[model samples]
Target: MESPPADTAPQTPALTYRAPTEEDHARVLAVLDRWWDGLGGDDGARQRAGLLPRLFFQHFTDTSVVVERDGHLVAFLIGFLSQSRPEEAYIHFVGVDPALHGHGLGGELYRRFFDTVRAHGRTIVRAITSETNTGSRAFHARMGFTEAEQSFPGYDGPGTTRVTFVRELEP
Candidate 1:
């Protein structure tokens, strides 16, 4: 089959980023499991949904972001300045429409988060992922996060170990 002319080929839609509102709770949850399906099976995805409670949308809207393409939800980054550690920020969770993986959407979301936190006086950013998640580990590394020497056992709960990452923001 012959390829379509360059001008006739489909173009990527422009993405819009904005702060998530309380009303977006349902919308994000609706797609959370499906977006995480590749990392975990259906059952795992269902369990993962519980990890992101409604609290992020309710209280962290200022630091959180939702991304869309043509009015459809495509990605999000839920993060916040550390209440206890004034110089630190934590990225609670992030998700990108799996179909758009490798398109730089995730990196762009992270860069936005970094800029926000840096403007807030945060000197460090931290995040975590399951030890089994090689994709996340690699992605974090690519994003300039340094992994801890060892996984933290029971970091999430009994029998759950997690790989922690930290990055120092350039001044």
Candidate 2:
């Protein structure tokens, strides 16, 4: 029997997907540093280098995933596997080069992330963002993440009023 007509749609160029190696740290940090430099206050800056890693980073390997298209870096999602449960991932950072922000690279990165975690038997994914980062909060919401927690501790920085989000994908 003749097979159904092959899909005529053109394939999107394969996104080069991989973990951020030590070599990628410079490029990734370059993007992050620029983003941080654009911030307008001293509060959040103070929290980043000193307070964050002790409270964040350090434990997650491949915590940063980069997406390269056309041999050029376009986007990244930085996070790590978690220990709270046998199957969970904590997303610490996700950044789309400003030039590519609205072009769906971020979403694609997230899709890859979920698939990677699911393949490893992970059941849930979690992330954090600042309360006033309306743009990011909205994006997470559209991605089907809901408000799991929100905190405002009267700290000196912008993200002191932080919002946490979570998505549970399985039992």
Candidate 3:
């Protein structure tokens, strides 16, 4: 394929990624709720805020940082640590505001997440995304994640059924 010329492709804007504060939970929840196509209601967000913190942020840690643009919370990535020894990291969720995508914010978030995990002496970083979420799969791949395993029995638990993608962190 001819490179389509440089002008044919659009340029993306720069973004910043930083830890989310308790104040951010409400906005983050709103973004996540909107992300899942109205699957999350007021009651659901309230309940999730309680249940999720225990599962991922009990120790005062955040999975992924918030992606902001022009002083607005456009998107964010969510992850957590493992219970195993030596301390491993797992990305519980990765998302972006559909309106704010294609600007490399997601890629930067992965790099930031990897750095945080590496700092903690974690050797591996893994996460699961649905098979239907092709965009996510591609984004992970772009961030140097390889397909370590594939589980396609169609299990039901989270947003939807999809294949799992595991990426081992660098040494």
Listed in order, each prediction's TM-score against the native is 0.89, 0.73, 0.70
Model 1's number of clashes is: 0
| Error in Å for residue 55 of model 2 | 13
Spell out the clash pairs found in candidate 1. Answer: none
Candidate 1 Cα outliers beyond 4 Å, as residue runs: 1-11
lDDT of 2 by residue, 60-133 (tens): 44545778877766776777677667878877778777766777877877877887787778878988876777
Model 2 TM-score is 0.73
Q: Write the per-residue lDDT of candidate 1 for residues 1-171, one digit (tens) a residue.
A: 999999999988788889999888889989876777646576467557877889999899999999999899999999999999999999989999999999888999899999999999999999998888888899999999999744999897776688999999997
Candidate 3 weakest ten by summed lDDT: 51-60
Report the C-alpha lDDT of model 3 over 1-171, residue by residue, as the tens digit. 767678888665557667777777667666666665443466445543543553233344555577777678887677766777466688877677877579766777778888888888888777776565567788878877776655555444544355666777768
Model 2 global lDDT (CA atoms, 0 to 1): 0.69
Model 3 reaches what TM-score against the true structure? 0.70
Quote the positional error of residue 121 for candidate 3 in Å.
Answer: 1.3
Better of 1 and 2 by TM-score: 1
